[model samples]
Target chain A: MSYHSAVLSGLGTYLPKQIVTNREVAERLGVSDEWIYKRTGISRRHRAAEGQATSDLAVLAGEAAFVSAGMRHVDAVIVATSTPDHISPATAPEVAARLGCAGAAAFDVGAVCSGFIYGLATATGLISAGIADSVLMIGADTFSTIVDPHDRATAIIFGDGAGAMVLRRGEATEPGALGPFDLGSGGEHSDLAAVRDGGSRHKRSTSPDHEGDYFRMNGREMYSHAVEWMTESSRKVLARTGWSLQDVDHLVAHQANARILATVAQRLGIAPDRCVISIEHTGNTVAASIPLALAHAARAARLRKNDRVLLTAFGAGLTWGSVAMTWPHLDPST
Target chain B: MSTILETATRILVDKFDASAEDVFPDAVLEDLLSDSLDWVEFAVAVGDEVGTRIRDEELTDVRTVADFVAVVEEKVGALK
Candidate 1:
């Protein structure tokens, strides 16, 4: 029989210490706590402490995952993020070096929120193809660094955090084994959500409103597209795994917003209790959201061994993906 | 129970989906049948009800319902 070769051996997460509450944001802009909560269901979000880079959080989560897995080494490291520490060298190499796992092939994936899932698929493929015996997938982002403090729309919605998972070669029969990934992208709607300035496109563009270049987005258009794409992606992944809404014990989605998650869950007919909803506190941590939510779920006792979990995410690049896997049985503090 | 605990319990129950009694004097913030967001919301709700805010750091050493009661008592005293 054909076999799946990667299993989630451990999980870990890290978020910055500072919290910017809705009330604080309200004081700066023409918005209220009620307005923000009614729309996004977010009351507060964590920001990275000063001088804390994306790599700092990634290293913390990677160390936690490695300790949990009881291993000091892995065959590869994939850091999924939109905000890398620098523009040239891959952030994964630095993260690996900090975690003391320097020999592994380290690289970065820039899929934004759907990054962890994409990273997982990359790691799984590596293991399945015998390119790597095991892989460390770290999703970290300091979204606050790129966000314009004066722009209320984006400032209140993005946070800084990291999450990680240790995936090792294992049998498909293992309970924590991951199924094939269901991934999709729509570059056509890329402008709906993107950092307008700072990229090569903006650098080359002759637009005089240069300051408008910082993370500008069409929120309304982005919302509609995100909901549609996420719904479709979730359905496709469930069907590919031969699992239905009732079969999924937990829905660990990217912590984008409460309304989007609720709409997707409602459309899928997945019970509200079956989902890990942690965005209210962390806001949208982009690539870090999924694994961060999963780590929180395990800590909260909401996730148990052998339970079927569904993870889905949609973000910039208009990239989106979903994965179905059985929760692996292991000591998180191993 | 001069409605202080009862009022607190109502807010906790509505925000946390926990039983009213779960917000008792000895209830631990982290150990309660609630999540981190629930506690933050609860603190805000208590602020609205008592006309005073309870910061997260203020409850760092508080682990049970009595600790929260002490906080409420202090708020009451400060208001008085």
Candidate 2:
């Protein structure tokens, strides 16, 4: 007859060693490095090596999370991604197996860029409903595999990386307990961002040419939608949590774009200092963005114990969500 | 000038830093605002001023300032 809250325990992140600078893609996309930086606020991004896979990144992050948590296993493993290692079998089980969490309930979640927040909401329920006492939640993606290196719009916008968090059951009064969340989707605008092929729709198509498998984003439309939805979602969650804009200690939003985060923070009346923009070094890591930002912020000490941290993200499915939490003190190595 | 067009022009001038003279009707959009992001930001700012969103579809036919102002004026009119 009690509610269990999913409390934060640890954080870890992994970025591939191969750092791809804007110059690498700009030449192909015919844009200057300064142009890419001026627009996306990215100087470079990490690209997975030829043999590397999404699961590989996830496993490394999961292991790092375990070390951060000082625990070797958990009751559940959830991998959030759009670029999975395989389509038939879910990616989580392999990630769990690779991380020595074989017996833990494992699965994959898809919400594109909002994957981390979506995974957080699901993991919180798993704890609240007593489905799992602890969960290893990971947001990982190899977007480089799906992005067209020559596409001027998307090529320089994405990077490959993974970030994981360990969550454990705790009381609501405990530090790090996640508060209310606002999760939503605008299915009507799904066409605004998508990979137009290789799915059931394309499989059933009569066309013989197998093409358009690359990720495509209408950055123009996406800009307005992302800023509006993320700001709205942030407001909703903050209201549900009974926190004012000024009460927020940090706004760790999806590193989708520097401009988007600034707009959302401005619309919400959150100060620029409170807005944690970690994408300058990593670019947009798709579903892995939030966790990566959190780990980056945590390691930098931007996050502190009992600090009110707001998390919001908008991405591919035209989905958006926000989660409120009081930061928990974790190992300095996080 | 119509209020809607004025709002559009103010956004272009104040928010996007488009020169007041350059935001007039028939002004080439590319000549006024070169960045691709400027169009979307300009639309959102105009939407904020007009109290109704300026959808992306409405901006498709926009090649010149006259064309964009027309769409904004029409959308604002429809709201009334």
Best by DockQ: 2
Q: Which stretches of candidate 1 lie above 4 Å from their native place?
A: A1-4, A204-213, A331-334, B1-80
lDDT of 1 by residue, A142-172 (tens): 9888787778668768888898889998998
For residue A100, model 1's alpha carbon misses the true position, in angstroms, by 0.9
Q: After superposition, how far is residue A19 of candidate 2 from its true place, in Å?
A: 0.3
Clashing pairs in 1: A197-A213, B25-B65, B25-B66, B26-B64, B26-B65, B26-B66, B27-B64, B27-B65, B28-B63
The residue-level lDDT of candidate 1 at A135 comes to: 92
* DockQ, model 2, C-alpha based: 0.56
Every model's DockQ: 0.02, 0.56
| Residue A171 of model 1, lDDT score | 92
Instruction: Give the Cα error of residue A317 in candidate 2, in Å.
Output: 1.4
DockQ versus reference, model 1: 0.02
**TM-scores, chain A, per candidate:** 0.95, 0.97
Docking class of 1: incorrect
- Cα deviation in Å at residue A185, candidate 2? 1.3
